[model samples]
Target: MTEFQILVVAAAFIVAGIAKGAIGIGLPPIAVGIMTLAVPLDDALAIMAIPTLTTNVWQAIYGRGLLRLFRRFWTLALTATIALVVVAATLGKLGSAQASAWLGVMLVVYSTIALLAWRPRVSRQTERWMNPLMGIASGAVAGITGIAAVPFLPYMQSLDINKDDLVQALGILFIFLIGALTFALFRQGAFDTANTIGGLAAIVPTSIGVWLGQKSRDALSPEMFRRVFLIGLLGLGLHMARGLL
Candidate 1:
């Protein structure tokens, strides 16, 4: 990576870190979305994988009863992993342009839902089947677009879990999907050594940003900030999709 790309990569991760720190999620979507402006979509995703995985590992373990939650959501994890690998190996081969377009679509769709706060509740009776089924769709989207914030986030939010448990659940799900994504990208030769090193280098800035964001979380209204951030991403997504038009 050139110096410019390196700087962009660091900045992207830092911003992603802030978002995640404040809201307990959003690291991958922000990091990869920003990096795609200065690098290829594959490179952006590769550079994002390590930071995302590391942060989510912490998020996954910080809460109580991780094992219990994992057991409850294991089906979601398994199906998501399988779908990620298969879809990435298949549709992810459609090249950068198609992937970029898909990324934009996901970002726009996710942002719209978040902005509207239109969450459809999933009752306990239907969750058993819905979890695994949604996992397939979520993983397919994450695989092709390298953004795992759509169906998965929404589905999880719709469940009856409390705030803290919801955070841990998302973390566990991300670990599985992102791990699968990393392997798939490597198998496809999209995540090479340069991307790996770049991703490693991003950890510092990402850490600092998260720390700062966590500090600010006490002072700022996270909901308001999230709205602003989502709006920015909505615009970025639209810009990326313009080529497809």
Candidate 2:
């Protein structure tokens, strides 16, 4: 990568890390979304795989009752993984423009839902079947767009889990999703040595940004921060979607 590309990647990840640190999620969406402005979708996705995997691994293990939660959500994990691999192996051939458009759609949809704070409660009875089904759908989106946020985040948030558990569960799900995505991208030859090294290099700025965000989380208003973040995403989404035209 050129110096300019490196700087762009660093800046994007720093912002993504801050969001993740502040809210316990959002690293991939922010990182990939912003990086796409400077790099191709495949390159952005390749660069994100390692950093996202490592960070979320930490997030997943930090909380209690993981085994129990994993057992409950294993179907979701399995279904998402399988679907993601298939989509990556197939639709990944459509090239950057298509993938970028798909990503734009996902970001806009997710941002809109987040901005509205419209929480749809999923009944316990519905959740029994919904988890795996949603996994399939989310995996397809992730495979095509290199993001697993949309329905996955919303679905998890709708659960009855406590704050800490919810955070950890999100980490676990991301770990699974990102891990699978890494393999899928590799199968498509997306991760070259340079991109992998770039991903590692990004960890430094990302960590710094996250630390700053964590420190500021107490002082800032979460609602305000989230609103601003979503609005930015909405704009980025529109910019990305224009590629399709």
TM-score, candidate 2, is 0.97
Question: Which candidate tops lDDT?
Answer: 2
Q: Model 1: which ten-residue window has the lowest total lDDT? A: 89-98
Instruction: Report, for every candidate in turn, its global Cα lDDT versus the true structure.
Output: 0.86, 0.86
64-181: candidate 1 lDDT, tens digit per residue: 9699999989999999999888988887552378888878888888888988999899987789999899989988888788777879998899998899999888888889988998
RMSD of 1: 1.2
Residue 66's lDDT in candidate 1: 99
- Clash number for every model? 0, 0
Q: Write the per-residue lDDT of candidate 2 for residues 146-167, one digit (tens) a residue.
A: 8998799989989877898888
| Residue pairs with backbone atoms closer than 3 Å in model 2 (clashes) | none
